[model samples]
Target: MIRQIFLALTLAAATALPVAAERIGDAARGATLFDRQCKACHQIGDGATNRVGPTLSNIFGRKAGTVAGFKYSKSITRMGADGLTWTLQTLDAYIENPKALVSGTRMNYRGMADASARADLMAFLRDYSDQPANIPESEPTARKSEPTLDPAILAIQGDPEYGAYLSSECSTCHRRDGADEGIPAITQWPPEDFVVAMHAYKSKLRPHPVMQMMASRLSNDEIAALAAYFATLE
Candidate 1:
C-alpha cells in the first residue's frame, strides 16, 4: 500500500513539473518593451493612426499588408495573396526577424533577438490584436522560399553616379545619413532592399500614394540607379 502511494505521488509530481516549466509571457513586461522599441514606428489600441508603420490593433488573423490606409511592401502583400495570415506564430517569427521571414520587407527593423522578450512582446500584442480563443502551441519555424525578382528589374546595372542625381527627390523626406525621424532612414541599406522597396511602391503593392506617384515616374533602370546611390551613402 505504501509503495503504491509513492508511485502515484511520483507520477503526479512529474506531470506537474512540465506544467510549471512552461513560460507564459508577462503582458506587463511586454508592454514596457513595446513602448521602448516599437512605439517609434507603430501604434496600437485607442485612436492610433498610420505613422511610419501601421496601427497594430486587431492584427492577428488579418491578411498581411491589408491594413486599410497603411502602405505595405509588395513582398508582404504578395504573401497575403499566397494566403498568409498573421497569427501569433507568424508574428513571433516576424518580430524576431522581419527580413528572414519576408525578404524585401520595407520594415527596416533588424529584429528582436531575445526569445523571452519576443514572447513578452507577443503577449502584449495579443492583448490588442483580435486573438483567437486558443493560441497555437508552436511558433512558425519554417521560412518560405523567396520568390524570384523580375528579370528586367534584375538585369539593369545600377549606376551609382547617375543614382546620386536621382536621389534629390528621396533626400527631401529621407535623411541621406540614415537618421531616424518619423520617416525611416534609407542610408547605407542593401541595394536590393532599396530596389525591392521602390518596385513595391511603383506597383502600388505598397499603397502610399505619394510613393506610388514618385516610383511611377522612374523606369526600372532608374530605380536600380537610385538604389545604388542610396546604398553608397553612410
Candidate 2:
C-alpha cells in the first residue's frame, strides 16, 4: 500500500510540472530583451516621445484613440473615439497579434509569439516609464512633477530623468516586481526592435489609430531617449 501511494504521489507531481514551467517575465530580463530587440522603434518615460512608432509610455491605461499626432487608420481612430481603453489583457492580445487586435493598425511586424517574451517586454516598458514614488503605506502622496502633455504630442528625444518621471503611469497594468492581474513583468528586449516598431506605427505600417496618433506626435530625438531609458530599467 505504501509503494502504491508513493507512485500515485509521484504521478501527481509529474502532472503538475507543466503548470510550473510557465515562467513569467522579469523586469530585469525584459529590459535585456528590450535592449536587444526593441530600441529601434519604441520609447517611453521621461522626455521620450513618439518616433516611427507611437510612444509606449504609460500605455497600460491609455485610451485607444489618444496619442497626440499619429494619424491612425480610420477604423482604429473610430475605435478610440468609441472609448476603448488598453488594459493588460487588451495589450496582451494586441501584442500577440497586432492586426487581429486592430484591423486597420499599420504595424507590419508580426506579433511576439512567445507569451513569456511579451510579458517581460511589458514589464520593462512599465519600469522605464514610471516616475519614482516614495510609496508610503498610504498612496505615496500623488506624484508631483508629472507630465501634462499628451503622450502623442510629447517630443521623442527623451530625458532619462524625465523618462523616469513619466514612467509612473505604467503601474496601472504592469507590476515592477512580479505578475499582477495576469500582467507579467518584462525586463528584456532590444532597442533596435523597439525603434522599428515605432517606425512601423508612425508610418502606418502598423494599424493602431491611437498608436499612430502618438507616433505621429513624436520627434525622432525623443524616440532614442526613450529607448535609452528603457535599456537601463532592469
Q: How would you encode candidate 2's per-residue C-alpha lDDT over 1-70 as one tens digit per residue? A: 1122112223234333322122224778888877776667877677878877778776655788678987
Error at 71, model 2, angstroms = 2.3
lDDT of 2: 0.56
For all predictions, the C-alpha RMSD in Å is: 22.3, 24.7
Compared with the true structure, the alpha-carbon lDDT of candidate 1 equals 0.73
Instruction: Identify the runs in model 1 with alpha carbons over 4 angstroms from their true place.
Output: 1-14, 17-24, 131-234
Model 1 per-residue lDDT tens digits across residues 90-179? 777788789988897999898987766877887787677643345553332222112225657767779999899999988899888788
Give candidate 2 misplaced runs (Cα > 4 Å): 1-24, 128-234
lDDT of candidate 2 at residue 68, scale 0 to 100: 90
Alpha-carbon local distance difference test for all models: 0.73, 0.56
* Superposition error at 91 for model 1 (Å): 0.8
